[model samples]
Target: MIGQVKKMIKQCFFSQNNIKYVDYKDLDLIKKFLNPHARIMSRKKTAVGARSQRQLAEAIKRARFMGLLPYLSR
Candidate 1:
C-alpha cells in the first residue's frame, strides 16, 4: 500500500532528473523507448508526458539515422 503510493507520487525519469533535452548519442538509453518492432513506445505505456515523448521519439529517429541504433531486430 505505502509502496504503491510512493511509486505513484514519483515523477518520470526526465522530470525527476531535470533533463531538458534527450541526447541522440545515448543509444543505450534511447533503445529502451523502442519496442521489438522498432516502434516508439506510447506515452500511456511508457508513463511519459507528451513533450518528453516527442523528444524521445526524435532522439531515437536521429540515432537510427546515424546508425547508432538498429532500424529493425532479428
Candidate 2:
C-alpha cells in the first residue's frame, strides 16, 4: 500500500513539471513508504537511503507550501 502511494507521489510530483508543490501531508505519505532500517553509504548517490531521508525532509520543506520547481530551477 505504501509502495503504491510512493509510486503515485513520485509520478505526481517528480514526473511532472506542472506540479510545482507538495505538502507536508504528501511528505508524510512518502515517509510511510520508506524503510526504517535503510542506511545511506555514499557521497554521490541520488537518493541514498538515510541521507536521502534527511534530504527528503529538507526537500519537503522547500517543496511544500512554496513548491519544488523553483528549488529544482536553482
- Which predicted model would earn the best lDDT? 1
**Candidate 1 lDDT trough over 10 residues, lowest sum:** 3-12
lDDT of 1 at 16: 74
Candidate closest to the true structure, highest TM-score: 1
lDDT of 1: 0.81
Quote the lDDT for 6 in model 1.
50
Taking every candidate in turn, the Cα RMSD to the unseen true structure, in Å, is 3.3, 12.9
* Clashes by residue pair, model 2: none
Error of 1 at 72 (Å): 1.8
- Over 1-74, each residue of candidate 1 has an lDDT whose tens digit, in order, gives 77666535535677877878999997777878789988888777777777888899899989889988878886
lDDT of 2 at 68: 25
Instruction: Estimate the overall C-alpha local distance difference test score of candidate 2.
Output: 0.40
